[model samples]
Target: MTVNRFLIPAFAAALLGAFGLIAAAQAQTGPLRIEITEGVIEPLPFAVPDFVDEGGAGEYARNVARVIASDLSGTGLFREIPREAHISRVTSFDSSIAFEDWKAINAQAVITGAVTVSGDRIVVKFRLFDVFSGQQLGEGLQFAGTTQSWRRMAHKVADAAYSRITGEGGYFDTRVVFVSESGPKNNRLKRLAVMDYDGANVQYLTDSSSIVLAPRFSPTGDRILYTSYESGFPRITLMDVGSLRTQALAEQPGTMTFAPRFSPDGSRVVFSLERGGNSDLYMLDIGSGGLQQLTNAPSIETAPSFSPDGSQIVFESDRSGTQQLYIMPAGGGEGRRISGGQGRYGTPVWSPRGDMIAFTKQHQGRFHIGVMRTDGSEERLLTASFLDEGPTWAPNGRVIMFTRETSGAGGQAALYSVDISGRNLRQIPTEGAASDPAWSPLLP
Candidate 1:
């Protein structure tokens, strides 16, 4: 995730000029009246029939079906009618569904799938239907792989059905790479952990011997870049997922660097370096191993993020007496501040849409997760709580993921996501204590 900041005076003038010409040309047209419609609406109810198994061989054949049901329910958009309420059972993919039975239970949609075992491979065929319209919504899908891959298959089927109906990409088929923490706060155990977006199939990529922070997924979802304290000091490292091999990035003496993010093209990494009692942003050329300093500020500057176009950089700095967001050229140059509100801001991250920036704002002793335009206009607060920091953007820019810690002893930190509309708040399960969650782009 990246944050964007643009100077107000120059940006506002350009917006007004562009709208003025369009308003004048439409003034000469005939008069028209616009009406606003209001009505009460309801969410559509759906039913997921129990997935049938032709041969009982793998545990995934039974477990994967329940996982898909939980994933859809967590979205808060779909209502899955229970199996006890199901009026008909689907035994084969070639059979027709009894649309009337589903309608009796007030189900607007229905999903059915069949699992079979062919030698060492697990085969699945699934279909989605609109009970109200009494028609198949889309083409059926077939997936074949080892039994361990059944969970991924279930997510892919759910993603396909969701995308076909809403015309938006599905996040269920993706994974999240976050830092898993354990032990006391002062001497904590941290490692890079990856799990399904729904919190299943958790795997630890690194051991707990070394401390890790800010694990970010590559744009291709095949690699990860993070800051590790493996060498008794903070250093940046990149890990290859397929080969499980990691190598140190660049070397800097007596300087601590953290908050690493990959470029939009995944060719370079930009991070923060603390040297001579000052912190600044820097970029490392992945191919040539060249070091380029990006900021020359005297204050603490960290949390560097790149714009979607890979032309500008947004970061947090305290050079203005308080922490605020600043924008500069990606190749290092003089920066301009864009946050002038009545508080301090940190963790400035840019949205994937290239329009707004998401960050954590502290005002009057309360923490807030908010979004502002590129020019610092239209600041909207999405969530406020005891301690909410580290905002990561959803792939579509409609949702934001962050971590919240409770107050007092025995308190724990957990991952959560909230939409920009201030609705659909959900708590994502973690194996243990978790923080600094980084959401991956849609899987290929």
Candidate 2:
């Protein structure tokens, strides 16, 4: 997961629907929009009242509304008007709108919903409205799932409202895989764990008896690729996310594999293979067990990432006398250098949009997370600290999450995310220190 940030201005804070949003009538001012640049003076104000409990929903209605508000608020692009300040309540799911009431409190947008819980299933529906324009932002939609997936239902509602407001794809329905750490900093125990995008509902995938690093999700997110040391040497291991079944991926005797990432089609994996103290990039066709070396340089070449279309690969190499970024055809070929910066760059990750690459840069004794255009122009540093590295992109490619470690003997590492525009820098809450976060594609 890789290359890092540059400050592109006038970033649109899009409101993408959760599952989907059908374009509807527009307001006199058109759809609500905001530029999410640095130095936020004000956030878009929105209101979400407690959902109406159609039947047997009880506390679920309130909890769902809270989660929706939390998700939107966390973005730093929207602010939630407290429920206590609301002038009216949503007593009925299909009730008439109170635009004047919401506007009186300076709310530009409002979200209303209803929840119905049947025996083993739950149905949640929601709508977004532009208060001043008195227009529904999009067609109302509902999501159905088992009762156990209640939180995901809430996230869907939030995603819908967010997408409607922002006009971009929503990321609320996504999950993140990360390395959970415990014990002293000098004697840390690490395990692979998966959790909801908001850091909720965490589940351990592998025990901490053996070390794991750089866990990456498959294109469909049904599997994971990570470097494991269970065999007393680093090897790329593939695991079925659902059943926890595992297998070694293309591990040859006397060769170590690490930093593996799935190709766009999920049929191949691109990773770094080290042999005889030299590291290079290689591609493995998972279905055929065929291996192809992509880079044959004596210099270390690692952190290979496929472009969204899988036509090319962006990676980091020290072949330029210093660590830097390069791009090459998916097949074996010579790589063209894209990074010409003063500092060393590594961990180049192509954007989901296929227009940018995110990475970590070390400059003047300071570590920074940054992003650059695919051709290596418009470089922008999003974050700077004692140690910030290994950036992973959000499902929508609008945000990047990575490891931020504190300095000193008792230093700690935690997961942090920042918008590509460099605003909304936030620390993801975890039970313990966490790192190497890989964001999954939005769940189906």
Candidate 3:
């Protein structure tokens, strides 16, 4: 996200001098644009040459380039041309462009970079180009970090490229928190765990001694809220992700608290509390330690999610004798039903963009992960299986990560992600079965 606007003019001037007429024509024209609408789909072809090594950087340079290519290609929007098919090579960061070479290979975009390693520190500088236009899409940028953080640097590069081209934010530099499960289906052991957005650098936050469920990241990404059964009853607990310190919240005698989610401003939390065998939604001020009941319905109400602007909340309830979705003011008021369909809806999560809300729907003996607008129109099921629930939105709101469980004697749950357009459904690699994934915002 760190872009150098000043360098763009200089880079464009350099390209104009190097490619002459092609660059002039490109300047007269513009960068290639792709219209992402409901229609026929075609992935844009792009190339990333192996990064040149400087100051004896060696293998790190090539590996970083490979990771960048993989990240972009995995999005299903960009196709990477193989290195063997690359007609031109990038030998230096400041080298002149060979627009004809890339144009001949039918590449619409090209990424070139150089890597420098000094002891434990590594620096990667890259530039993106419009191959056909013969113009630099953006200014050259560099990222400096430790060698151990090379993957993060590569993700940063991919995110920058994706944003500049698609005119949208990227989710590459984020994390996911979920419950990792082990043992048999009948005697499952679950613990809270977290990892990079790509499922790398996993770190367990809690031991498996107690069952954990519905792990959620705070808006700031520095804390986590989840339901734990350590005391033999589900209770909401908030933990400092860095210190691994936890403190139980909404503790009451003979009461169970669960399904906790942070407010948009991280000043309060909304969750479900079961007392006298009835579950209802309640809001708790994190700093004041005060609680307020938001719903007084006789039916069960839970899975409340606050809108991005913190003015409203979307949640699930069975007030009509069937599970359905409802929206209400954040401060508590009459709820308006938003879901009207054949199936039962639950686990409604408001999208970051404030345009759509994702949910889990059950119909015809099948579970699906789907999304619809705030007014309950344009419902589209992204995936259908024996069980696909607990949809969590990416930071950019372009993708959803959810839990998919198989149906059988050995049924298990795992994490999966799909774009909002219902394409690129893929399973995220985890060390063990995982569920209830919550994605964090882009890292600082």
Candidate 4:
């Protein structure tokens, strides 16, 4: 079937070239594209009929397409035309396109795929098209994984589709590690939990027997660094994601270590160590068990995050008389202040792109999640509420997830995400109350 699409002027040329979009400029109909900006734009209308099951796949075929639909639609950039209104059904893996049929339903784009199962393995292949232009959007792609990895395979497909149209890296195939909270507000039990970015496939890493806070995924996504209270004090603990093995680091006799983050190369960890009455930043070499102090300030310095290249560290410090953001050499030095706003800022996290820094700010009794350029200019607040803190960037740095808490005795903390443009602010689905979300890099 045919679908009619219109390419947005803001991003059309670049997207057309990146994905090999075959729509001719002189054609009567254009290719579908979304113009991402701070303003509201109608989502691109698309359709995904159930994926064709080659053999013995049964529900896996339909489930894969459903997941892809969910992934794209959840971004608020695409809208799925319900299956009920579909006039064309995908009947075979290599069926011919019916561009006219899709165009009748006003679908700008269409996705079709096939699922094949052999023994314990599954392979999914997909193609996205601009139905109105009668041309495919991106190159053909397929993902192969074990039967148990079907969801990830689906996410990979969605990621490809999203990237081709938006000209931006996709975040669907990543995970988030956060603190899972339960029980009463006054005495909540906390544990380390990991889940898909959309909050599915939840797996707890540490039990609630000991409180876990600020779980950060390693650059490779194979390990985690977090602060644990099992030793009767906040100690930074490292855990192998696959084996669940835990190791305590920076175990000074009289100091407390917390807020640990991994370097871009995953060979070192930067954290905060509190001793006497002062807290400062420190870096630990993972292989040689070497330690180095990065700060010697009397005031607090914590929440250190490394730039993507591992050359600079952006952290929150009180050395400037009030909490603000600072950027220092990864080898340690007197960093310069970056945040000149009239607010107290903390929990500074560097974006994977190394172009922006996301942080939490408090001013006039309102908490906000905001981002600014690495040079500290063009600061923009993305969210504001009673209590918003702990900002984490998605793999592409296009979106940010942070913890938002309500006020009062029965206050609860939940996760929320917003585009860097400060649009599409919505709560992330969690089993219950959760906080301190850390997004892992895109899965390899």
The true-versus-predicted C-alpha distance at residue 334 of model 4, in Å, is 1.3
Give the TM-scores of the predictions, in the order they appear: 0.86, 0.93, 0.93, 0.93
In candidate 1, residue 230 scores what lDDT? Answer: 93
Model 3 regions lying over 4 Å from their true place: 1-30
- lDDT tens readout by residue for model 3, 146-194: 9988888898999898877665688887889999999999999999999
Deviation (Å) of 331 in candidate 3? 0.5
TM-score: model 1 vs. ground truth: 0.86
User: Better model by lDDT, 1 or 3?
Assistant: 3
TM-score of 4: 0.93
Q: Of the pair 2 and 3, which is ahead by lDDT?
A: 3
lDDT of 4 at 9: 56
lDDT of 4 at 405: 96
